[model samples]
Target: MNNPFNPSFGKVPNIFLDRAHAVTKLSTELQNPNSPYQTTLIYGVRGVGKTSLLTDVGNKMSAKKNWLVVNLTTNYNVLQTLIDSICQKSSPEIKRLLDKIEGIKLSAFGIQFEYRLQELTETNYQILLENILDKLQAKNISLLVTIDEVDPTPEIKNFISLYQLLIRENYQISLIMTGLPNKLSELQNDDVLTFLLRSARMELSNLDLLSIKHSYQDTFAKKGITISDDVLIAMVKKTKGYAYSFQLLGYLLWEIADKKITLATLEQIQGEYLATLGRNVYYKVLQELSPVDHSFVIAMAKAPTQVVTTAYLQQKLDKPKNYLSMYRKRLLDAQVIKSPARGMLEFTLPYFKEYILENLKFYV
Candidate 1:
C-alpha cells in the first residue's frame, strides 16, 4: 500500500491544512489595505513545514497577486546575497544605472556586485533603498522576501538592519522570515526592530490531535487502506504529532502496507526492531555519545519518565559524576534532548523513550 501523503514528503505542495491556514493568514496580511504588516516572522520546531508553507504561499501569491518573490536561505555571505538578489530583478534603468557606476563589475562566487553610493553607508542605504523601491513601485510590483533561519546574529543582523532602515523610510516591501522560536524573542528586544514588529509575529505550533488524525486518515485513504481507529491512535500517540516523526512512521508503515495493519502484526516486528524503533532515534544520537554518556543514557532509559537528575546520573555512572557535566552539554549540543527548565530533561525525540523502556524490558 503506497502512502497517499508520501508524495508530500520533502515537497512543498503537500502542506497540511493547519500550516496552510498560517500561510493564508500571512498572505491576507500582505494584501490587506487597512493594516498590512511590513514584516512577518514565522517560527516553529524543525520539520514542521515552515519552508513548505512559504513555498505554497509564494506560488499562490505569484499567480494571484503577481508578487515578486525573493527567497533567501540563510547561508554564508547572506547580506551580499540579498544585495545580489535585489540587483538581479532591479528595473532595467536601475540595472543600467548600477552598471554605469564604477567598481561594480566584480563577481564573487558567480554573482555580480552592484556599486551605488548608498550601498556603503547605513544612512545612504536608506536613500538608495527609497530610489530602488520607488522604481519597483512604478511598475506596480510588490515584493515578498522570505528569509529562512531567523537567527538575529551576525549574518542576519545586516539584512535586518537594512530592512529596519527601509521600514523607517516607509518602503513598500513585505518580508516573511522563518526560524527557531528563540530567535523571535531576540528580535523583539532589538530597539530598531521592536517598533517595526508591531503585530506580524506568527508562531507555528505543533499540529493538534484532530489535525494529526485527519492527516493519517487522508494518507491511508489515498492508499486505499482502511486503518482501524486503535492502530491510528497508537501511531499518533507514539509520534506525538511531530511532523517528521509522523512522516518517518507513516513512511515505514507504508513499507509494510501489504495488508491491513493490526496490533498483532505490529507486535510481530522482527526481534526488538519495533520496540527499539521508538528508541533507535535516541540511540542513533546516543552512538555519537562517549562511553560515560552512553551509560548515563542507558540509566535514564531504565528510569521512569525518562527523567534524570544530575545526582541520579552520577549514581548510575558510579563516579562522582561532576566530571559528567560535559556529558549534559554534549547531549544538548547533539540535540538528543533538552532540559525544560532546570534539573529535569526529556527525550527530544519521542520514540526514543519507548525504545529505551523496551530495551530495559528485554535486556535487563
Candidate 2:
C-alpha cells in the first residue's frame, strides 16, 4: 500500500490531524460579514502546520457559493498578485464587469492590466483593486484573500494597508494570513500595520498525543497492519505531538515495518528521522534566530531538566535578569521556547534539545 503520511514541508498530508476545529472556526468567521475574525492571522513554529491549516481554511471558504478565495504568497508583489488572482478566479460575468474598468484588460491568455499613468504609486494599486472589489461586491460576492508565509516586506505592508482600507470601506472582503510567529509579530508591531494587532490570532500548538495515537492506529489498521497498544503509545510519544514529526515518523515506520510495527524497526529509523527533521525544518528554524538567541537556546539545552528557570539561565549566561528577560521574550516571540510557568521556560519543539546538542559544533 502507498504510504499515507507526507513529510514534505508546506504540502498537505494525506493523513491530516488535530486542526478541524480551527478550520471550522476560521471558515465560519469568514462567512460572516460582521465577524471580527474576517482578518485572521495564523502563526506557529516550523513544522506545526501553519500552511496546511491556511490552505484548509481557504478550501473551506472556496467551497461556498458566494466566497471567492484567492491564494497568494508573499514572494511577489502581493497587491498585483491579488488583483490577478481575483481576475482569473472570477466568474465570466464578474470578469466582464472588471474588464470594463479603465486599466484592466482580460485576455484568453491571462489578465493584463496597466496603469494609465507611467509612474505607478500605492494609490494606483489601491484604486485598481478597489474597482475590482466594487464589481465583486455588486454581485453579492465576498472575497477571501489567503496569503501563506507572510513577511513584513514593503509590498506586503502596502497590500495589508490597502486591505485595511478596503475593510473600512465595507468591501465585503476578508483576509487570512499565515506566517512564522516572529515574522507575524514583526508585522503586528509595525506602526502602520497596527490594525493587524486587533485581528483574530491563531497560534498552532502541538497536536494532542491521544489524538495522534488514535490517528496512527486508525491509519495503520486501514492498511491491515497490526501494532500493539504499548508500541503505538511509544511511537506516539516519539512524535511528541508535533504535526510534521507525526507524519515523518509514521512515514519512516510504514516504509521500514512489514505487516506489524516493532520497536526494532522504530530503533532502526531513529537517526534518519532526526537528521531529516534537522535538514528540513530545524536548520531553517535556527537560521531565523540571532546569535544571542542561539546562545540562549544552547544554554537551555544544557540544563538538566526539560523545564529550566529564568534564574538558572541568568546565572548560566552570567547575564543580568533584565538581559535574560529580553532574550526570553525574543525566543517566546519567535515561538522557539515557551514559559510553562512563572520563572520557567521550555523548548517548544519536540526533540529540539537533542537537535541543538548534536548540531552544537556548527553553531559554536
**Candidate 1, 1-364: lDDT as tens digits:** 3343432433663426467677677777787634545577776655556777777777777675445677787676665555567667555555665544444442334335355645655444444455656656666667778877667776566677777666566666778887665566677677766753574777665567677777777777776767799988877776666665666566666667655766664555423434444443444454545666666667777666666676777776777655767777766644466787677766666666666565554433
lDDT of 2 by residue, 5-88 (tens): 998877767888879888889888777788879999998888899998888888888888888999888876677778889999
Query: What TM-score should be assigned to candidate 1?
Result: 0.68
Q: lDDT for model 2, on a 0 to 1 scale?
A: 0.87
The lowest-lDDT stretch of 10 consecutive residues in candidate 1 is: 1-10
The top-ranked prediction according to lDDT is: 2
Point out where model 2 deviates above 4 Å. 114-119
Worst 10 residues of 2 by lDDT: 113-122
Any idea what lDDT model 1 has? 0.63
Q: What's the distance in Å from true for residue 44, model 2?
A: 0.8
Cα displacement (angstroms), candidate 1, residue 93, comes to: 9.7
